[model samples]
Target chain A: MSTSQGLRAWLLTEEPTSRRQARMAAWYKGWLTLRSNTLAMLGLMVLVVLLLAAIFAPLLATHDPFAQDLGQRLLAPGEGGHLLGTDSLGRDIYSRLLYGARISIYIVALVVMVAPVVGLIVGTVAGYAGGWIDVLLMRMTDIFLAFPRLILALAFVAALGAGIENAVLAISLTAWPPYARIARAETLTIRNSDYIHAIRLQGAGPLRIVTQHIWPLCISSLVIRVTLDMAGIILTAAGLGFLGLGAQPPSPEWGAMISEGRKYILDSWWVATIPGIAIFSISLAFNLLGDGLRDVLDPKEGQS
Target chain B: MSAIDIRNLTVWFGHGADRADAVRDVSFEVADGESFGLVGESGSGKSTILRAIAGLVPTWSGQMTVAGETLGPKRSKSFYRKVQMVFQDPYASLHPRHTVDRVLSEAMQLHGVRDIDTRIGRLLDDVGLGPGFRFRYPHQLSGGQRQRVAIARALACDPAIVLLDEPTSALDVSVQAEILNLLTDLRQEHKLTYVMVSHDLGVVGHLCERIGVMQEGRFVEVLSVEAMRRQQAEAPYTRHLLESSINSIR
Candidate 1:
């Protein structure tokens, strides 16, 4: 109780003791605002559950997700120790859903890591350097943007050979164009700000100006944008998986599971419908979380 | 030698059909430890002169020298070490995400200054802000306080020439006097050369020893503060400017 009180005091302190403390307090304040938002909290809770389920999948699954008992095929939900039921192959739906969370998260993590960073560097450099450089980078971004996201991802995946890694790489290559556009837009505005000019007066070169001065301002907007893009990223990955271009058979990937269950979907709806529901719920969770993050992180709202 | 020298400085934007001259062949010199002011109406290019000196704008032809070093198309790191600029808007001048400590420390680090921890403490104190304010973000401070932090950041490099781009124009009238007084004290203490730009005649007069009146991108007159005070301006435009300034005050 005393420790909790001490932590609360520290978070609320106007005078922070160190740089770390100050940064933490600023972040804690953002968390406090986020906590007050109910829908955001709900979205955060769902994501937390998804993360936990992925981590504890082996321990939590009552049966091996890959084990196929042909006799038990097409069992309804809650029949014979299968809580969510069995797929057409008799693999437990409940256990597969738990493990599938890892694939979805992994793809999301990898795509998120690759796309926005590439976008940020490209956008900031193009925006700050301006002139021929701006024309060159932005034109390149425009070319990438001209392609439909899924079609581009599909084309890349087809060439790279079918697998989850190829799917992630494809999505990352397609996803970065929007981020670059956003970062470039944000950078164009930020580069003209007085703080940037002041930094330049300190003899900071274009690289330092873009990375240190301009990037910090651009990040808040980019973070909000990246969060909002998560749902689209998830859907794109799922589309690849459903098309049999991602996560090979028996991997229990949610989309692939849905693809396999499609044959039995008409007779026993739970097979495909269950994994479809899982995908829908996770996508909805991401949308909600992104909206909540937008409220907290949007610089235009003066929260920053 | 003068601390700052500019000969036949011509600054413009765009080219051909879209050309616009901001400062045209303007020549001026500021002696060591002198406080020079550029006063003009908006769009008269008072701030452009400072921007040219600080190397913020590239489309310029000029012979510019500061602290015994000549300026070229590109500014050297050592040039930045000897010169720094405080922007007009305090709110806009500070990095919103960075704390006051970070802003000050970054400026020092750029100049390769050591013993930062102690220097930051002293800088904050010098700007009349206490040590407790160091960790606070710009949003956490008032406009006046943010300006103080900006001033402190400029001082962090210990530049011999500190350019003031209408430092107090965005501040409250109540806070403006305090900031002006602080600028005066710091100038005397550091023996720094200043080239300040402002539209407010009273403000320019308060800080600068000599004031240049600009009209239509050219200097109409350069007069001492005493001459301005005595209304002894030789140029017809200078007299009109003084009259408008007095009328505005009245």
Candidate 2:
């Protein structure tokens, strides 16, 4: 038979009754291939633990995070009821770490959520629109990127005046440009895709094409980029708090605790060490999760 | 009345030192439901003419009317609903991330098609794909299957006209014939007008009612398949091309 005839026959042929089950079996086999990646499994585990810790912190911690006892100040780890020892202010270190996690996790989640939404809107419009709109939006993004992110964020914080809300606003504004750039690049690529053109040819408007075709395809990359950005936001928020520009004292911010503990580092290593470890662990968890998600979510990567 | 009418169409790209006219002062007419083929070598502007008609290449200056509606500088959604395009590379034409169902449903949804699942299922079956294949992504299918899916996508809006840009050039010859037959069947079934651009004369002869040979942005010769086969084309360029194709077959 000729090649076309063979293809027609193959396309037309009805499979046996068990073929559907076999296809499902093959799909599961592919899923199992992904599940077998050791690093991804470990990353997922770490992410779940950190998420649970952040979610159930109040129930998990023994003491009120903000409550203080002057007599308990500087008590070392394992001394009486001060399990992780007391900070310089005699605040319970363990409770503060738990509450500090609340701040760090909240900032990361909020920044990640808000930044990508802004980015998706800006990037999809700019990239898919192309021509003058693309040029104007991209140049604006370039201007944002030209300034060092931290300094730009610092200026925004200064303008807004220092506080948790201002710090979040500052970070979010600075952070969105990266997601915009990623979304724009991905949008540019997706706009040229046949499915998008096909939709356009089918009398779909620009908004429909972008929302239905371009957005869904670019979402995996966006999700991965947002996951990675979560780590950076956490670190940046902590840094701002450390510099006393965010989350004022006694709010149990990890960076504030570390900053307050710095002067007595030699006398009470536990104060800085506990929150520092928390920051390190949470950031590491996000980084690992982002990497695993990048691998798994990419259809091309997963296939291989 | 003609289903498509074009007069004095010229399409240019870039400006100043880099300016190039991709399609220049080309004109053609296709009677309603007629299968018209545009044939040429690469860079011969056959594809550009189709693009201009389909409203893809908006930088062209032209008088193009499809189904009696005057073509405009920018395409409208309603214009697209009437005329659609199928590109050469099936691989690049379909989004790999979407399942066959999503790919097919988008156009229907855009057109506010009611009872989308029934339409999609019927379309899949019409394109010779089983119901089981509807949920599979493009990458899961082979080249010919993807091309069939592309065809189904073009047909989804129930377009009266389709601009086929070398629709089978990327496929194996045998698969090309299948697509040609599928296109032929679809045109007859829907009474659709086709403006297909192709370099392969054999495939065009097999499918199109009339063929216009394009060269250097102009229609050098327009002939029926019977005229082409009977006269054996005495034009030097056409003769040369025929000779080369015959030699290749030998």
Candidate 3:
């Protein structure tokens, strides 16, 4: 929050007693910041609305997204029961967009949850382990990083089946290297600190020191990086879906919805434009949310 | 059994010609409850000897006996609690993230000592700090106050022996005497054994009953506090040290 210049160090200590209270204070501070940031608040509100729309899709959609009326095909806006109009087969565009949120939300959930954990483990271990282990692990990370991200994801998805899970797995494969590098650098900084040595002398084993001392200190950076990476992950997932390598058709995935509407772009613009807008808003929301989180998570960076 | 006994202890660092012996073939014994001071100039290996005993230095070959028990490469938790260390820089020594309360209580908790709050409060009082300083972080305290907290931490385990690594060197000169005085009072009150390292001969003279003048990884001579204070050091190196030490004072 604006009231504090920086975080106190003791909140990061291994003590279990003060931790919950301090973390609650930190979150309260972060919420205060979130409230002050108008754009982030707007982004949060948009995200919440999208989520609610997705959950209530069954109730909100007047017609099934898949059920098509060939007779009323390509109906214009404000015509019949179709409020925003219909697609080539006369399917409701609004219904499809709401359902598309589920696919986007699922892919993002999977990628963000899995990628950073993979990276944090690999990086911190390699950094803390040092010597040949560090050399071997980091070089492996470098090898993965040498390839272009999208190309690597495409290759992995191609090798696996062309499905949403495959795309998520592929995205994860390309996503973890940078996180590993971040985690490794953070671990190196923490490993040499005098506090680590002090803990070691206090009869704390390596595991104790890493989990209690190193992980907590490194988590703030990892969280900021991971949150910021969400937009890119979503874009990549959409790219896969557009290429027919993600969620199959009839599932109402945003990218697939766009791809389906591509041929009718000249005659009916709303079909593709509506889904495209959905993707754009979600990505913007993630970026805005990320910027807000970075402020609260690392207040020192915000100040300087 | 002596508080500490080392037989031909040798600690080295690096490899080949780059290899340097920090404490080489050095043998010494500190009696129970005796305040032993290792007085030497910088890079003279006094601190290295302290580190070797503290188990901070990984590679060392020798027989080390503490309170009748033989020590191995890895000292046990019980052994760690039995012998604690106070590092040179008070600012550098304590964990900045941990409050004085946690710093004092963590070791006791590890050793399964109950009554943590009372012990912590008493430890604060023992170091000339108050209960108000308990939750304060290291940076929140002044140099002297932090050093007091460090001393309190070292004494928290009811340790039989304490290692002092230039404990007052990092403090302001005005605060140095107060810390030294606190340390002296704590040692006497607890009847604790001390193996303190200091480059300043006078500081050691005031704190230690017997002082060892270490040079080039070995003790040139060990003299009584009375002999050192009376300027009756025997070895030529000891006399040379005394002269420079006195000259610095002048």
Per-candidate TM equals 0.98, 0.90, 0.83
Q: Residue B191 deviation, candidate 1, in Å? A: 0.4
> Compared with the true structure, what per-residue lDDT tens digits does model 2 show for residues A1-304?
6997864444433331233443443355445554777666676677677677778988988788888888889889878687799987788888788777778877877787787888888899999999999999989888866777668667877788888888888788877888788889888877866666666677777887788777876777888888777777888888989999889987999999999999999978988998899888777777777777776667545352
**What is the Å distance of residue A287 in model 2 from its true position?**
1.2
TM-score pick, better of 1 and 2: 1
Q: Which candidate's DockQ is highest?
A: 1
Can you give the DockQ of every candidate in the order shown?
0.71, 0.44, 0.28
Identify the candidate with maximal TM-score. Answer: 1
Query: What are the Cα lDDT values of the candidates?
Result: 0.90, 0.80, 0.81
Query: Per-residue lDDT tens digits of candidate 2, residues B1-250?
Result: 9989999999988888998998889888999999899988999999888777766677888698888799888777777778888989998888766667777877688777889989988998887888877776666688899999999988888889888989999999889888888888888888899988899888788888898888898887788878776756756777776677667878
Residue A86 of candidate 2: its Cα lDDT? 91
Higher-lDDT candidate of 1 and 2: 1
Sort by DockQ, best first: 1, 2, 3
Summarize candidate 3's per-residue lDDT along B58-130 as a digit string, tens digits: 8889899986678898889888778888888777767645667677787677667889988887888888877
* Model 3 RMSD vs true structure: 4.8
Superior by lDDT: candidate 2 or candidate 3: 3
Candidate with the larger TM-score of 2 and 3: 2
| Candidate 1 clash pair list | none
